[model samples]
Target chain A: MENKSIEQLNDICSQVRRDCLRMVHGVQSGHPGAALGLTEYFVALFFKEMTHNNQFQMDGKGEDLFFLSNGHVSALWYAVLARSGYFGVEELGTFRKINTRLQGHPATEEGLPGIRIASGSLGQGLSVALGAAQVKKLNGDDKLVYAVMGDGEQQEGQVWEAAMYAAHYKIDNVIAAIDYNGQQIDGPTEKVMDLKNLKAKWEAFGWEVIDIKKGNDMEAVLAGLAQAKGLTGKGKPVLILLYTEMGYGVDFMVGTHKWHGIAPSDAELANALGQLKETLGDY
Target chain B: MEKTLDLKFTYTEKKDTRSGFGDGLLEAGRQNPNVVGLCADLIGSLKMGAFQKEFPERFFQVGIAEANMIGLAAGMTIGGKIPFTGTFANFSTGRVYDQIRQSVAYSGKNVKICASHAGLTLGEDGATHQILEDVGMMKMLPHMTVINPCDYNQTKAATLALVNHEGPAYLRFGRPSWPIFTPKDQEFVIGKAWKMIEGTDVTIFATGHLVWEAVVAEAMLREEGISAEVINIHTIKPLDEEAILASVAKTGCAVSAEEHQINGGLGDSIAQTLIRNNPAPLEYVGVMDSFGESGTPTQLLEKYGLNAENIVKAAKKAIARKMSY
Candidate 1:
C-alpha cells in the first residue's frame, strides 16, 4: 500500500478498533483493552510508517520487520496485518478458534504470514528485534527492525538484560516502542509495580528515547515513528514511549484495567462498536 | 551367536569435547558464511576464541546475559543466519528455558544451542553449575533435537553436522578431557547409534562421557567371558530405536550409562523404548537422584557411579535379571 494520508490512516485505525472489539467479543476470550489502545500505533506502523511488504516472507530480507513483544494485543496486530494485505481480512473471524493461525498470542508455529516469532510470555521481543537488527547490519541491509512492548512488561529482568546488550553493543538499526498505557491486568502499573522514570531508565540504558505525548492520535504516532526511524543507524537503538489509553475508543472501557484481557459482553460490544466508526468496513 | 564387531580401539590424544565444538564451529563458519557465533561471556570456557577472532563481524559477545543471548540467536535465524550460542549447559537450558521454549523451539528457529560443561563432569563448580537434567528438559520440548556426543571427535563432528540439521538443536558436551577413541574422520549422523561391539549376553547403551566407560566395560566383560554389546548412543532424543531393539533382540538385556541423573537421562529413554517395543531386563548407571559437589572429574564420576565398574556391575545385574525372568 502507498503512504496513506493521516485521514486514511485514522479511518483504518477506527476499523481496526472495530475489528479488535468484535474479534475479542467473538471468541469471548482475548485481550481487548491493550488491543484497542494500540490500534492507532499499529495503523500508523503498517499503513503509513514501516517500509514493509504485505506479501510476508519469514526471513523479511531487505524489508523492515516488526515484532509484537506484548503479544496479548495480538488482536490489534492481526487486524492491521490483514488490512495492510498480508492475508485475507476475512480470516480475522478465526481469531482464537481451534486450528487457526490466529492464536491467543502471536506465533510463527502455524506459519502466520506476518509473525516471525512466538511471543506472549513477555520480555523476549526486544532481544529478538536486536538480533534481527544485528542480522540486517551483517547482511548490509539498510532496513530497520521494530518492536513494541507493554509498559508493565518492563518488570522482567530479561528486558533489562536485552536493554544493556543493545547499548553495550551499540546496535543502531532497530526502533522499539513501549505501549505506555500505565495499566496492566490487575490495576495501574504504579500501584502494581511502579515503572518509575521509564524514559530516564531507557536513557540510562543508552537508548535514544522519544515520547509521543498523544500516542492515540494517528498523526502523532506517524510523526513519532518517523522521528524514531530517522534516529536509527546513529550508534544507539531508538525507543518511542507511546502514551496511549488502555481502552481509548470506548468510553466505558477506557480508564480501567478491567478490559485488559476479558472479552466484551454483547451490550459492551455494541457500545464499543458505536464509538468506533465503521470506516473501512468491519471484517 | 550374535556377530560382534572388532572391539580393539586406540587413541593417541585426549581432549575436552568443548574444543571439538570450537574447532568444528570455526570450520563451519569457514564453510558457511551464514554461520554466526554468540557467546554469553564464556569465550574461553566454550573455546569460541578462534571463531571470534576469525569472524569478529559475525561473533556477538552478548555479555553475561544468557536469556538475551538465546533470544538473539533465535532472532538471528530470521535472515537465514545459523547462530551457534555458546554457554554453560546450566545457563544454556535451565536458566533460560522459557526463552528457548518460546523464541527457539516453539517458534521453529534454526538455532544451535551449543552447551559445554554438562553434567557432573563440569567438576569443582559444584551442583549449581553442573546440569544433569538438560537433556531431559530439551528433549521434552517438541521439535527439539537433543544430541550428547561422547568425545572430542564426535562433539566436533556433531557441531559441523548441526549446520545442516535445519532446526532447533541442543548440543550437550562436557569440560573434562576425554579419550578420543571415536574416528578422527568419523561421519556424525544424528539419531544413528554407533555399535562399537556386538554381543549376545547384554547391551550397554551409553552417551557423552560414559561411552568410553562402556568401552572399558566391554573389555572387562570379555575377560569374564560375558559377551557384551556396547553402543554409543550419541543422539539421545531420536533414540535410535531400531539399533536399540535390534541389539536388545540379540542380547535380551540392557544397561544405560551417562554422566547425568538416572531419573530423566538416557536410562529413562531406553527403558521407555523397551517397555513399549521389546520388554527386556535393564539396569541404570548414573547419578542416583543427587546433586554433584566440588571434586575432580574422576572423583565425581566415580562417586556418581558413572564409570566402567558401574557399567559392568549394571550389565551383570541386567543379565542375571534376564535369566531370572
Candidate 2:
C-alpha cells in the first residue's frame, strides 16, 4: 500500500471500468451500475494495495482473500480476473453462456480462478467472507481479506449480524466496502429502504468507519484504501462507505435501476459500447 | 477426504442415535483441522456439548437463530471449511428451507445438516418438536443426500462417512434411546441397505427408530409361521435399490415402516423401488396421516400404529394382498 503510486492505480482503475463495460456488453447481461462505481476500491486492493498472486489455485493459503458479496456484477469480476492474469481475457465472451467457466454468477464449480464461492443470492457473502477471514486468522496468516457489499444489500438483517460478529471478534484482518450507488432494482435505495446514517451504524457496531467521495476517482479511492490498510489488525473491523454514481460510464444506463438485471439488446449494447473505448480487446 | 476407519467396533453397550452424531462430530473435528461445527442453541439437546468443549474455537453457538445459522454455514463453505449445522428436525428443514435451498443445495456447497429430535419418538415435545416431514423435504432437494440411520453405532458411522462425501447431506436422528442392534464395526455406506433377516413371505423395509421396531415385528411374525424378511433402509435418497428389488422379488410382498407420516418416508421409498424393479403388494405401517401427541416413545409408536404389532398386522395384510394378486 505504501509503495504503490496513485497514478498507476488510477490508470488500472480506468482499465477495470473499461473491462466492466465491455464484458457486460459482450454478455448482453449483468449489473454495470455498482461495478463501475466500485472499480477504484477493487483496483486499489488488487493492483496496488494488497499482496496477492495473480495465478490463483483453489486454496489461498498465504495470499490475500477477497469475496464479492454482490455477485450480480460478475462481468466486472471476470474482467478483473482476466486483467489480473488469473485467466485469459479472451474467455470473457463465454460469460453467462451455457458451457462457459464464467457463469452468470461467480462460481467455484469449474475451479474458476479468483472465485471461492458461488454467490448469486445476496446477503450470504458477508458471513462467508468473515468465515474465510476467521480461517486465515486461525492458520496465523497475516494477509488481509476484502469484501464488497452493496448498499441495498444492507437492508438484510444478516448483514448486521455479520457486522456485530466481526467487530466483536476485533476482526482487523478483514475490510468491507459498501457500494453506495443510491439505487437498487426497484428505485433509489432511500425510497426502497433508507440506509441513512449507515456509516454511523457501522461505527456504533465497533467498526472504524472510513468514507470515500467519488468512488470512481482512483486517486482518492487509493488513498482511502491505504488508510484502511493502515488500520488493519487494530482490534476493530473497518468499513468504507464508497459514494458512487450508478452505471458510471454509460450515459444512458446511468442514474437508474433499469440496467440492474436487464441485458442489453443488440441496439442497447451498441449504444453503450459507443461510450467506452476498447482499451483491452473485446471478447 | 474419506478416511478409512481402522477402529474395529464391537458394540457391547447400547447408545442413543443422537449420541452417535455427537461422537462422530468430536472424531471428525479431531481428524480434520478444517472441520467446524455450529448449533442453534441445541448443545445439550443434540448431545453436542462434548464437541463444543473440546473445540471451542471450531464450534459456534448461533443462539436461537436457525435462519441466520444456516446463512452463516452457507457462507462458511465458501472459504473451504466444512461446516456442520445442527438443530431440531422441524426447525432445520422447514423453518429455514429457503436458506438451505438457495444457500447450500442450489450453490452446491459441502455442508452436513445434522437434525435431531425427529419423528414421533420426540415424545412430550409433541407435534411442535417432532418433524415427520423432514425426510420428504430433504429428499426433494436434487443435490441433497438424505440418511436415516437405524441405531447409535450406525449413526456414528454415517456421520463419519458424510465427512468424506462431497455435496449437501441431511443426517436425521431421534431423541430417545432405542435398540442399538447391528455390528458395531459395520461400515455405513450411503446407498447400501443391509439385510437383517431372511424370509420367503413378505419383505419388511424399515429406517430410523422403526428399524428396531421392524426387527421386533419379524421375531413376532416367526411365531405365527410367517417368515418376514427385514431390510434396514438407512440412506433414503440414494436408496439401496438392488437389495430392495432382490428381497421383494423373492418375498412377493412388502411392508415399509418408519416413525414418520406414511405419505413420504421409507414406505414411499420401498414402494417406488418395488414398483419399478419388482411389482409387489405393499402395505405401510406408520402415522396414518395425522400429527403426533404427547406420549412416551412406546406409547406414541402404539398410538400412531408404528409399533411391532402394526407391522405384523401390515405384514399379514400384505400376505393377504399377495394372495389376491
Candidate 3:
C-alpha cells in the first residue's frame, strides 16, 4: 500500500474508530477505551510510519514488525491489520466470536496473519520485541521491531526486567510506545498506582524517550513514530510516551474508565458511532 | 529354566545431566547456525560455558530474569532462530509458567526450554529449588513436548533431537552427578521407551535420575529369584503407550519410580495409561505429597524413597498384589 497523507490517514482513523466501537458492540464484551484511544497511533503506524509487508510471514525477516503488548485493544489492531491488507476487512465482524481468528486477545494459534505472539497477559511484549530485534541484528536484517503497552501495564515487574535488559544489551534496533491513557479498568492509573514521572523513569532506564503530547492527533502520532524510527539502530531502545484519551472519539466514554473493557449497548453503540465519522466503509 | 538374564549394564563414568545439555547445545549450535542459547545468570551452573564461548554473538545472557528470557526465546522464534533457554527447573516452569503458556505454548513458538536442577536431586537447595511438578506442568500445556532423559548420553541425545522437533518443548534435567549407563551412540527417540531389562514378573517404568535406580532395582530383584523388567520412559507427554501396554501385558504388574512428586509425575502418567488401557496392580516409588529438604543427593534419595531399595520393595508389592488378583 502507498503512504497516505495526514488528511487521508485521519480519514482512516475515523473509520478505524467506528470499526473498534462496532466490533466491541457486536460482542457486547471487548475493550473499547484503549482501542478508541490508540486509533490514531495504529493508523499512523500501519498507514504512514512503519515499512512493512502486507503479505505476512511468520518469520518477518526483512520487514519491520509490531507487537501489541496491551492486547486488550485488539479491536483497533484487528481493524488496522484488516484495512492494511493483512486480511479481508470483513473479518472484523468476527471479533471475539467463537472460532474466530481475532481472539479477545491477539493470538497466533489460529494463524492470525499479522499477530506474531499471543499477549493479553501484559508486560511481555517488550521482551519479545527485544528478542526479535536482536535476531534481526544477528541476521543483519537491519529492520526495526516495534511494540505498544498500556500505562497500567507498567506496574508489572517483568516490564522493568525487560527495560533493564534492553539497555544492558544495548538493544537499539527496537521502539516501544506506552499508551498513556490515565484511566484503567479500576479507575485512574494515578489512583490505581502512580507511575510517577514515567518519562524520567524510562530515560533513567537508558531509553531515548519521545513524548507525543497529542497522541490522538494523526500528525503528532506520525511525527512521533517517525522520530522513534530515526532514533533506532543507535545505542539504546527508543520509547514514545503517547498521551491518548481513554476513549478519544466518543463523547460519553471519553474521560472515565467505564469503557475500558465493557462493550456498548445497542443505544450506546449508536451514540458512539454518531461521534465517529464513517470515513471509509465499515465491515 | 533357561537363563533369564545374560547381560548386565554397567557405567564406568559419572557426569551430571546438565553437562550433557551443555555439550549437546554446543554440538547443536555447530550443526545449525539458527540454534541460539539464552541463559538467565546460570551459565556455569547450566554448563553453558562452551556454547557461550563458541557462539558469543549467538549466546545471550539475560541476567536473572527468567520471564524475560522466556519471552525473548519466544520472540527469537519469530525470526526462524531456534532458541534454547537455560535455567533452574523451578524458575523454568513455576516462576515463568504463565510466560511459557501465553508467549510460547499458546503462540506455538518453537522455543526449547531447557531446565536443570529438577526434582529432589537438585540437592541442598531444598524445596524452593526442587521442582517435582515441572513435567506435569509442561505436559498439561498444549503443544508442549515434555522430555526428561535418564542419563548424560540420553540427555545429550534428547537435546540434539529437539533441535529438529520444531515446537515448544520442556527438557528437564538435574544437578547431581549420576551414572552414565545408556550407550553413548544410542538414538534418543522422543516418546519411545527404552527397554533396559526384560522380564515377566513386573515392569519398572522410570524417568530422569530414577532410571539408574530402576536398573539397580532390576539387578536386586533378579538376585531374589524375581524377574523384573526395567524400562526408561524419557518423554513423559507423548508416552510410548504401545511399549507400556506391551510390557505390562507380558509382565502382569508395574512399578513406577522417579525423583519427583507421586501426584503428577511419570507414575501418574503411567497409572492413567494402565487404568484406561490395561487394568493391573501398580506400585509407585516417588516422593509422597511432600517437599524436599537440604541434603546430599544420596541421602535425599534414600529418605524420599527414590532409591533402588524402594523400587525393589515396590516391585515386590506390585507382584504380590497381582498374584492375589
Docking band of candidate 2 = acceptable
lDDT by residue for model 1 over A20-109, one digit each (tens)?
889989999999999888888888878866789978899999898999999999999999899888999999999999999999999988
Model 1 global lDDT (CA atoms, 0 to 1): 0.92
Q: Where does candidate 1 clash, by residue pair?
A: none
What stretches of model 3 exceed 4 Å from their correct place?
A: B1-7
lDDT score, candidate 2, position A257: 82
Candidate 2, B131-164: lDDT as tens digits: 8888888888878999999898899999889888
Q: Ten consecutive residues with minimal summed lDDT in candidate 1 chain A?
A: A1-10
lDDT tens digits, residues B226-315, model 1? 999999999998889999999999999999998888888889999999999999999999889888999999898888888888899999
The DockQ for candidate 1, computed on C-alphas, is 0.90
Query: What lDDT would each prediction earn against the true structure?
Result: 0.92, 0.82, 0.91
Candidate DockQ values, in order, are 0.90, 0.31, 0.91
Tens digit of per-residue lDDT, candidate 2, span A74-112: 887887778788998888878787889998888776678
After superposing candidate 2, which stretches have Cα over 4 Å from the reference? A1-19, B1-15, B74-80, B287-290
Candidate RMSDs in order: 2.4, 5.0, 2.2
Q: Compared to the true structure, candidate 3 yields what TM-score?
A: 0.98
Q: Write the residue-wise lDDT of candidate 3 on A201-271 in tens digits.
A: 99999999999999999888877877887888889899999999988888898977988999889999999
Measured by DockQ, the strongest candidate is 3
